[model samples]
Target: MSEVPEVRPPTVTPVRVVIALCLIAPFVAMLWVGSYARTGPEFIGIPFFYWYQMAWVLISTALTMTAYQLWQRDQRARAARKDGASK
Candidate 1:
């Protein structure tokens, strides 16, 4: 049988880093906004602190979706490599 060429999967560190940043950025922003609650006016009819935290709910969802996509891609690549090796 012909030897199957070794397939090197793309590095996932960057994807993980991006996901981490996505998760962290909103949290940091929320904290900053919360700190302003002692002084700042309401945001979009809601309290600054409340809206800030609520904003993160959507951001977290998006970040989770991104992470999931990255994981799925990695899995598909691994599966393809295995399939190739068995051929």
Candidate 2:
């Protein structure tokens, strides 16, 4: 009888860690409202409190996209590694 090979779980990589941070940043920023709750810095009449959150919306989108791309690349690399190991 032939025995099945063991499969190991993927290890954490720097790219994955960065991707996690990118994904969590927006959530943490919004949750910590004290960080941006202010009115002194206004952008063309918009209060800092409002504008900061609005700015994060765009920044969050970019971060999310970046994290997604990194995640895809990481997945591909892992897949390739698994294929190589299996062969």
- Quote each prediction's TM-score: 0.60, 0.86
Per-residue lDDT over 1-87 for candidate 1, one digit per residue giving the tens place of the 0 to 100 score: 996677666665676677677667766766674465652467867766667677778888887788778767767878988898778
Q: Output the lDDT of residue 12, model 2.
A: 82
The residue-by-residue lDDT of candidate 2 on 63-83, one tens digit each, is 999999999998998888889
lDDT of 2: 0.91
What are the root-mean-square deviations of the candidates from the true structure over C-alphas?
3.8, 2.0
Backbone Cα, N, C clashes tallied per candidate: 0, 0
So what's the TM-score on candidate 2? Answer: 0.86
Q: Say which candidate scores most in TM-score.
A: 2
- Total backbone clashes of model 2? 0
- What stretches of model 1 exceed 4 Å from their correct place? 1-12, 20-39
